[model samples]
Target: MKNIIIFGLFFLMVSCKSNPVTKLDNKTEVGLKGNWELTSVSYPNSSYIKINSFGIADSQCFETSSWRFISNNNQGEMALRKAGCPTFSSDITWYVNQEGNLVLKFVGADVKAKTVKEGYVLKVANLTENAFQLFDTVDVAGKTITLVYQFNRIK
Candidate 1:
């Protein structure tokens, strides 16, 4: 009888164990839902500049730009606001790829070619309720540049 009781207790504990992968996926999904504002842009090779350090015009436009991620449908939108330029908004689909990379697909038809470009895959450095950081590398003029974007959740 004691052995049977011990086995029963062990079975209950085992049945209650949650899968780690499922837990992480849920946490990441929840953490990403919100309005995120670009706070800073970092370039390791070049001089790092804060969003506020940009020129008055650029600062105003950049400060007003933000990214909004919707939790219900996994869709996102990027809003760019500039004083002289017309307000630009793009439809984007976001998802965590199989390799855990954050992928942003821009939805639009190219004017000349009538082709849709591929999405941008960014490595997620950190993601939390209050902050998110993404890292990516770009090659420009034969020089490799590491781009880091820091965002803060809007209250």
Candidate 2:
């Protein structure tokens, strides 16, 4: 009985698997620490289709939007300023997840981030010193489309 128990313990220990390690990239966040402007939003067949990004106003509303990303505390703010568009601004808490995705939570309404139930996740791509792109995939008419958000450094 002792021999059987010892073998069982060994087998159990050998079969146990540890959690996978997360590949979080801090370099991407470092590169994003600055002021930027949302230059454009585009997708396939965008001439005919309109998309309201971030569940906010029309895609055009985000044009010329100012964004400030503070790398120290992972805090930021975004404001939209366009004629005939809904006014919007928010304090944002953001981080790059293990998969190199940008995770964003809006906490501007004097609400704690922990209490915010919804957030936005976007794929970071084409990162450069002066520009980058955020890709968002959405389903329209039973088809998947990639939406691109272009950012340009304000220098």
Candidate 3:
């Protein structure tokens, strides 16, 4: 009887283990569902810039430090308002690759990349809890390029 009870408790403990990735319900959309702030950005050759998001309205307007991330499986959009640019608004489609990485597609938003900045789209690969990297084929001159943008969770 004692052995059986111990085994049962162990089984229960093991069954309750939760992985951050699994907590995300594909049906409900996961990590992107809350408020996030940009922590650090890495440029070519390991250059670094530290930044904090400031805005008014939860991700609706950038004030001095804040950005809101609201997304779904079919589509997701970021509303950025910075001290310099208060009237910021953009929408993008969110998709999941077979590898379970979340990607933001510009063309997926039904707009031409050339019409925007980089030729029409972007992709994010290797996303993990509290941090992710950004890949964009768009640059200031409209050339194909990729860079990793790292982010941390706030609140």
Candidate 4:
């Protein structure tokens, strides 16, 4: 009876150990749960103009933007800080699709916010504990433009 009890306890302990793949997935999810600030935006296929957050002149709204992803709830918020500009805050539903694409669905009442209504699906070029990179391609004026957005986790 004593030997059987010891074996049972040992089996339970081993069974409770988390799978390595699950642990790694959890770590990646945790890494994405935080506030992130847009650091840079680049148009690689076109003019190759790389603009830093501070150097954004055309659109002040995007110059001071931040995103917060809530891993537990699978929700997010996009805050645009455009001083003296129309304030805009977007409640976003985010998820990783089966193909590993990062998808963002915007929920709001603003009719003018049509750009995000259909949802934005971006390729996750890179992701780490402190940095994230997203890539997408859009057609404008019959030209294909590749946009790369780089973000840094906010402390």
How are the candidates ranked when ordered by TM-score, highest leading? 2, 4, 1, 3
Query: Candidate 4 clashing pairs?
Result: none
Give the alpha carbon lDDT tens digit for every residue of 21-75 in model 2.
6565689989999999999989999888888788888887898999999987889
Instruction: Name the candidate, 2 or 3, with the larger TM-score value.
Output: 2
Please give the TM-score that candidate 3 achieves against the real structure.
Answer: 0.43
- Cα displacement (angstroms), candidate 4, residue 125, comes to 1.8
Positional deviation of 37 in candidate 3, in angstroms? 2.3
- Name the TM-score of candidate 4: 0.63
C-alpha root-mean-square deviation, each candidate: 10.9, 4.2, 14.3, 10.3
lDDT values of the candidates?
0.66, 0.90, 0.47, 0.67
Candidate 2: stretches off by over 4 Å: 1-23
In order of appearance, the predictions have TM-scores of 0.63, 0.83, 0.43, 0.63
Please provide, for model 1 over 1-155, each residue's C-alpha lDDT reduced to its tens digit, 9 standing for 90 to 100.
99999999999999999876512244565678989887766665444332322112333354456888886677777776656744666766777655667777755433322254666778776887799887767665677676677889989
In Å, residue 24's CA in model 2 sits off its true spot by 3.2
Q: Answer with 3 or 4, whichever has the higher lDDT.
A: 4
Q: Which residue pairs show backbone clashes in model 2?
A: none
Native-to-model Cα distance after best TM-score fit, residue 151 in candidate 4, in Å: 0.7
Q: Give the TM-score of candidate 1.
A: 0.63
Stretches of candidate 3 off by over 4 Å are 1-29, 45-73, 99-121, 139-144
User: lDDT per residue, candidate 3, 1-155, as tens digits?
Assistant: 99999999999999999875623336323655655665544445333422222212322123233334565534444555455545545555554454445544433256753464432223454556665545533342444344444555566
